[model samples]
Target: MRTLRRSRSRPWPLGEPTSPDGQISTVDLLLVRAALHAGATPGQAVTALHDRGGVLDTTARRIAAGEDLPALALDPACPGGPLVRALAVAEVAGAAAGPVLDGLVDGVVRAAELDRLVRTRSAQARLVARMLTTLPVVGAVGIAVFDTGARTFLTGPGGLVLVVVAGLLVVVASWWMRHLVASVGRAVRDVDPLVVAMRRIGRPAPGSVGVPPTPGEGLPTVEALELLAVSLAAGMPLVEAMGLVARLGPPAVRGQLRRAADGLRAGLPPFEAFPEGLAEAADVIDISRRWGAPAVASLRLLADDLGRRAAAASEAAAEQLSVRLVFPTTLLLVPAFGLLVVVPLVVSAFSGFRLGP
Candidate 1:
């Protein structure tokens, strides 16, 4: 099996001109696909894409000059990203150009859609975070610094008590908000978009979205299902397709699928050859074997249906973020407003009435 490189957190090597955030552009993947379709070598494809101009452009020269294309694709720092990984896998496996191209086109479409969803959620999160931090601070500062009457009240014993309580509320609110927001970010980061779409294929029914499977555990099964479906569509034999998937899929999932492939070679029935998570996939294959119904098309439709459900789930999560913010706003900001602005101004008014008498 070919070894996959570990993802690095260090600065990008080879001076790749990607965004600081390390996201791969969809345009770059398409350009590479076009170049490859026109009979360019993998290295030549990247080199040709330089003129189209994006993050992937800068790495073209290096790839053309014989830098390990697979290594570059696997580099977390490489702007080529997951689509590049798919292409590199296809190239290394010497799979037919048609299947590889089909996978790449499908992968690009899925990646682009998922990227849009992620970007929208991220932007909304940033806006909510800014509002949470700014609104209360601005209101407090305006009352404390600008109002002369409230400024006087702030110097007395009552103001000291208000300051202590408000400070505590602010600290708690900040911590709680950070905790919630960080969890949301972690959930998004923990699963790959392709994995999510792939896993949806094995799920028993449509729209049965559940807590995301733990990273690494469910990967081999679902990944094998997708790869096997695609390969079978391309007319690869069942055992041969499983073996290919074992080698070409991500390193993390390789060992498990390799065993499944071995089982198939040992004459195990389709259902017994795969992991329990892949029972639905196995059933489809079993049907294909007995009746020659097209498993690939059925699985493709299943994948697409589940992909939409996954996208909808992400949209729902983004929308829920606004509702979640209400907790911190009510608990901390509202009380802080009363302590910082309303209470002080009311005290200032009462004191002025006493002085007038």
Candidate 2:
């Protein structure tokens, strides 16, 4: 038998270096540079180089530029390097499996941002709840203490009765305050309707990632569709028209429209470019595609539907509030008012009609 020739493969490097503070060392930066030179993007290079820690965008870019990673890592602005390096390692692993690095970056970034928002909202709600619960209890105790001192200065049974009445009032007031605080806590815990509605509307379509609109930014979906229709009708390229709208429209709409434009640019069929969220308006998408006319007509119809739904919700909320108020006024307030006005008069009249023993 012929002797088999041994095949030799290049040996990989040993462990990467760490800073005195346990950050990426200079050697790691060189490795990242090598990855970039081998055709990886700056993001990919960072992902590939840092096998165990999170990588910052700035540091990643610097590594791609063949800079010393350890020096940049020590900069004050480059905080959380270890966590970033770990994330970068996961990113690289995903990429090595043929997934897109940019998608990973986008997902990680968006999730972090959303988590921050949730944390902030939770903190605010907690603070408000604490204040509502504490302030009333403190005030009630203070008033009760003051009333006890006032009682000490009085001597007669009438004065004792006054002190008891004041004590009773304080107890009742404290209970009321506790109830109010509980109600407020319940409200804080309950999800806001507007938040629910926005979340529903903002859910990304299949294969699409939706971005939140900036503050006071972005056109409504109807407006964006209308603009797209106009631009397309005027002979503008789909991609160019989308870019124009993104530039002129609100930030929320811009990111979405830009994504749609990207799909178009990437050679996705026009009908496929329709947002998944627009499935409820499928007929419009189909009709627009068939007629090649402005998509404005379909968008207008959808807007009408949205308007009607909004109006219905508003009407229902108002009707419920009115019904609730009516019961409270008629059952509680009216009886209380009648007792205050008519009962005293009847008692006085009865007292005047004395029967002889």
Best by lDDT: 1
Give me candidate 2's TM-score against the actual structure. Answer: 0.33
In order of appearance, the predictions have TM-scores of 0.67, 0.33
Query: Which residue pairs show collisions in model 1?
Result: none
The count of residue-pair clashes in candidate 2 stands at: 11
RMSD of each: 8.0, 19.8
Q: How many residue pairs clash (N, CA or C atoms closer than 3 angstroms) in each of the candidate models, in the order given?
A: 0, 11
Each model's lDDT comes to: 0.57, 0.39
Deviation (Å) of 356 in candidate 1: 15
Per-residue lDDT tens digits for candidate 2, residues 1-357, read 000000111211111100012223334545554675587654556656433443334555566577543344323234333223222322322223112232233323432343244334334333433343344334434434554432233234543454455445434433443333233222311222222334567574332225442211111453344344444445566566665544443223344556666777887755575445334444575677688766645655564454334334433432233233343334433343333323333443465576888
Expressed as tens digits, the lDDT of each residue in 122-232 for candidate 1 is 566547666665665577678778888787777778887887888777778766666555444334323343344445554422222233332212122334455566667
